[model samples]
Target: MIGEMKAQQEEIELLLSAFDRLVEIPDEERVVFRTLIERKTIPAQSHFVLIGEPTADIGFCLSGLFRLYYTTPDGIEYNKNFCGKNEFIAAYSSLLMKEPAYFSIQALMDSELLVVPFRNFETLFDRHACWEKLGRKIAEGMFISKERRERELLMLSAEERYRLFLGRYQHLENRIPQYQIAAYLGITPVALSRIRRRLT
Candidate 1:
């Protein structure tokens, strides 16, 4: 374990703690696991990995945000998920399979990350039963998240969706464009404008 790296991330300790729970490892074990990790940072708008590209690594954010999105035939990008600071962000299926990714991961903010290749990760994770729990957690989370998105799209009114969005991401209302919110909520931008007007 690299003690120096741990010392350097004093500001993002909470992030590490959250990951520790997901991976079901103690801080000490995590540090040992992290000793072999590679560190990197990228600016916003940079693609971390692109669709159909081979992915061998998994990454976790220490700070900043990430967007995992895919483009349609018409070249429209619908965000699949936003990986926030401290969260794990990886094309897990591809990385684990050593195959091409289905979606692209991009930095939405200036980002810092810890990366580990599939081989190294497999070595550590396969050795610990607890590490397998992380994979289950990720899978289960993806399922629940899909359900929530479906419910919001099919059930919520445009205004209600806008309100829910503001409740969860108050500042993001400004950081994110109204059009993007409209796309996420499956509404027209004009409808979003009306919702915003009603709120104000």
Candidate 2:
């Protein structure tokens, strides 16, 4: 029991450190934020959020990997994004609109997350300017990421996208399956293999 408590404490410290990197939080505000957090573990191949389900929390990945994907009517899945340790994941549009999520978030590996209700954060936004700034920054970052992804898909060649993917997710290459990477690049697994050969 003591060991579990100590581990939870360590995770909380890590969460605080991550927040500190983004924006400074006053001790009182930090305490309030801490109270809002819940530690969650998602096993490999399990989902944190599913399509058409309401998601009320935003998760900070403490460890492990996740993929956000959308499925077609025929059940084909298209990879939209990947989240790794120290990253945040949420169905932002769904949360903001108070609707069911359009995409699903699945754990690619056993993952631990620091979860907080979006509503809790919304409350904090009214209490402090720092929280508001943090929220704004997070939103801006998401917007930039979305814009970049769209540009890459529209303007870049498959080979070029593969190169960019390597540069951006080099550490995750071995950890993620090649088929998923191919899906993320919007290419067939065979094409991805050819690209790898051409690069080598």
lDDT of 2 by residue, 1-200 (tens): 99998898898889888878889989999888878899999999999999999899999999999999989999888899999998989999899899999999999999999999999889998899999999887888888999999899899999999999999999989999999999899989999999999999
The lDDT per prediction is 0.74, 0.92
Give the worst 10-residue stretch by lDDT in candidate 1: 7-16
Q: Which stretch of 10 consecutive residues in model 2 shows the poorest summed lDDT?
A: 13-22
Model 1 residue 163 lDDT score: 82
Candidate with top lDDT is: 2
Off by over 4 Å in 2: none
Cα deviation of 40 in candidate 2 (Å)? 0.3
Instruction: Please provide, for model 1 over 1-200, each residue's C-alpha lDDT reduced to its tens digit, 9 standing for 90 to 100.
Output: 68966655663455457666676576566666656677778798787889988877777787777777777878877667677666777887777667898889988778888776767767766667766776678768777876887788689887887788788667666766677677666667898888888878
Q: How do the predictions measure up, each by TM-score?
A: 0.82, 0.96
lDDT score at residue 182, model 2, on the 0-100 scale: 92
Q: Show where candidate 1 strays beyond 4 Å.
A: 1-15, 23-28
